[model samples]
Target: MNDQGEELLARVRAVLSDAGFDETATGAEGVHLIRHARGVMLGWLPEDLAQPRRRGPRRSRRPAPADLPGLRRAFGLAMAAALRAAGLTVETRGDEWLLVAFERAADAS
Candidate 1:
């Protein structure tokens, strides 16, 4: 990851963390997951895909989405907006687990 990548990831971490996903969880295949609810998992996945796990109990389900669609769209939008506001071009890839890339205009030249 480059400096921009690091910054982007940091921003993501902050956004998610502030949204109450402070629990650190590990997913399958060395993937990182932030557990927010009973079956909600969030992360910057490889294929940009992610699914929920039936974790015993949920702490606070406030502002929880009904399904993956809600999670994806809402969180994805937040990430895109944050990245774009930071002057980085946000590229989104995948569905089940969304993959996001941050790029600068100069880097494209």
Candidate 2:
């Protein structure tokens, strides 16, 4: 990775770590690696729970399995916002992996 790529990777690591996700699962090797070419591909595991959750008004901190999708969406948006705030024109997308493409300044014209 180049200098820019390294900087971006650090930024992403900080973002995800602050949001309760780690690049590596507990007691294991790194969970994912960042790949950058035209864009950056960041892979991280979603929620860990496997069982369905009960319908209720009150619950613990953990989200229901069904809520994983929404949770991921929130995380993605948060990441994108952070990147934008850093003054990098960016387009973010993902399923279980996040793909962040920086809109090069020269290409913005």
Candidate 3:
């Protein structure tokens, strides 16, 4: 991973944590979601899940699950909007439940 990727993951972790998600592990291929204080409502997509990957011949090169395109796009847009609403910029890569979001500083006028 590059520096930018590391930074992006950090930002995602921070945002999710603030939104009530717990940090369970720092592993590369783990998915995490937020649990509300009362546990009534779980965190929504994009922020709740990491990019979904299927087991492949080689663990390093797995394929993304099907049925993720639309969901990923919608989740990405929602996350982006949420980040923007918090005065941050978001960029996503990949499709539905597999999208990853990175927070960035808004452009200075």
Per-residue lDDT over 6-29 for candidate 2, one digit per residue giving the tens place of the 0 to 100 score: 777777667656655567745443
Tell me the alpha-carbon RMSD of every candidate: 10.4, 6.9, 11.2
Q: Write down the lDDT of every candidate, Cα atoms only.
A: 0.47, 0.59, 0.46
Off by over 4 Å in 2: 18-21, 25-33, 50-67, 102-109
> At residue 79, what lDDT does model 3 achieve?
54
How much lDDT does candidate 2 score? 0.59
- Worst-scoring 10-residue span by lDDT in model 2: 25-34
Question: What TM-score does model 2 achieve against the real structure?
Answer: 0.52
Work out the TM-score per prediction: 0.39, 0.52, 0.36
Off by over 4 Å in 1: 1-23, 28-67, 102-109
| Clash counts for the predictions, in order | 8, 0, 3
Give the per-residue Cα lDDT of candidate 2 at 23: 75
lDDT of 3 by residue, 51-88 (tens): 35667653523335553557655545655565456555
Winner by TM-score between candidate 3 and candidate 2: 2
Candidate 2 residue pairs that clash: none
Scored by Cα lDDT, where does model 1 land? 0.47
